[model samples]
Target: MYRWLLLSYPRDYRRKRGAEILETVRDTAVTHRGTRVAANLVRHGLRARLGRPASRTVVLWATVFTLACGLFTASFGTWLTWLGSRPLDHDELAVAVNQLYPDKPVSHIDRDDPPSVFIIYGSPLSWSSASDLLLGDGGEYSLAGLGASFEQLPADSRPRVLAELLQRLRASGWDDTEAVYSNAYDCVPDDPRCDPATIPSNITVYAQRGDDILEVSINDDSTTPKMSLALTRSTPWSAYPVGVVAFVLGALSGWCLFGWASRRLEVRGPLAQGSAKFLFGFAMVMWWAPILLSTSLMLSHHLSEPHPRWHPLWEWLGQPAMSLAFLCGCLALGVAALSHRLPADQTLAHP
Candidate 1:
């Protein structure tokens, strides 16, 4: 374990000091010493990669860059995991819905075959949608799957009906948790007719069977009944480990690359350095803005609803939808890297 932890350090540094570090750890007899030493090694090794240990600014920027890169890699790994799983087919979803809610007949069934990556305008991504994805209606892109709209049940018996459905699900080999209740939607206090008490609360039940997840929602209004069932696939167990490993590797790479750029630009002329910084800052904005925006929206959504299967990490980061922005960020970063050069005086002196 000690020897493996040494890999956290840069290769050259590990080669020179790894044996000494290992020997010291071996000599220690403290309780839980391995855990403490492992944490210390990771912390110090990452810091050592940043080079200018005294510059807090470098550390801050490196951290931000690392997190963004880590999320991207994690999102990629998650998408790869999704590719390995099966999508809920139309016929299968119909059968499951019938078994789960026998008496509550569905008014309509909607089948959406989402792309392996993302859906644009309720369809697979395409060249025509490229304009919409970036400039026009990118916000419409969402993770969609099978859905069924059930005929409304009597308002008074809604709770009893939902309880029966939950019981049926458990008997059919589905694992479930307690039902979650929340306001159907935010009430408008200013409106004269908007009485909060009269509005029925939304009841949601979540269940999982193998890699599949089922969500049953009951929302009835004064004039009409509204209920729906949605089916989605769950992230595989392997994706967690894949995300963790990718995050560590991405963070390390981001720190080392940022350190290299910091050192290189330090000796350049003022204009070159300034340009590089500006471009890098723009790249960061392009990369991180969608993540921040999508994260807030997704967070609110999950909080307001009962989700047996959380959306993929990439959706929260607004990937594929913001693929254009990511590409722009990459272009800006590449330009920053390629444009930096040694000053003429240094070049002459070295030559």
Candidate 2:
């Protein structure tokens, strides 16, 4: 660990002093002096990286990195929000229907130039709850949603449509097996689309391929002929290798930016103690902790079925946590920058 971490130092410095540092670490192994060594290595590493970076370059890239972090965080947050709200059972059918025909009219509609929340086409059950979360100056034009409706179809065509859907799904890499019927899935409490009036008294068939899930229902709720189908795709983001990329980038860049700012403050006066500076710098990086906590909360919900009451805690903390962390780091930086003056008594000498 010590050796690897030491490699973070400037290449030339490491080349000259790497063996000496390692020998010293071995000599002081029982006392465990490696922490101090690693800390100095990083301090020197920063100096090396900064190797006379112009003020303009520093300010410009700092802004770029900060903006990049914000963009990434926003994107990741949107993705997480969308991922969290993905339709599971009956809701999926509703969303799929809405997307299939968004131009269809509905009631109780809320509209926005780029909407955050709106109900799509249908009577009571068809009005899908949709949010154009991606709309704004830099808005996302796409939507992830669910909607449902009872369409007239002959009883004879029911088997044919289902069989055709099954064949297509199988051809598209879905499992050949179909899900067993369950009366227990009668009505979902949160879904207004599952109002118990539109769904049939007959059996429902569910099929799946990875994250893609398809459901077909035979509803005799209406006096006339009608069939119910709901399709949903719920992606558990944190599980996939690509899914966590945003979270990882958010946390890492946040740490690095905070670290860089705090280091600048530390090196202002006399040669700051390497250990103290590192601790302070690292502590500043923990501002991203709130984001991590929120992410964990979301992941827990995705990974498990339990809806613990404490789940709201995660939502509540999501932004506040990041805010608090950023606030604390800024407060520290402000104080340090304000108090720190140019070094006149001592200078940081080569270790």
Candidate 2 Cα outliers beyond 4 Å, as residue runs: 1-5, 9-19, 22-206, 210-212, 215-227, 230-239, 243-255, 267-351
Candidate 1 segments whose C-alpha is farther than 4 A from its true place: 1-54, 102-105, 110-118, 136-139, 182-187, 221-226, 289-305, 318-328, 340-351
> Which run of 10 residues does model 2 get worst, by summed lDDT?
130-139
What is the alpha-carbon lDDT of model 1 when measured against the actual structure? 0.78
Model 1 lowest lDDT segment of ten = 340-349
Give each prediction's root-mean-square deviation over alpha carbons: 4.9, 13.2
**Best-matching candidate per TM-score:** 1
Which pairs clash inside model 1?
none
Model 1 earns a TM-score of: 0.76
Tell me how many residue pairs clash in candidate 2: 13
lDDT of 1 at 185: 74
Give model 1's clash tally. Answer: 0
Supply candidate 1's per-residue lDDT for 203: 80
Model 1 Cα lDDT, one tens digit per residue, 57-120: 8788888898998899887887777667676577878888788767776798865455543466
Tell me the TM-score of each prediction against the true structure: 0.76, 0.35
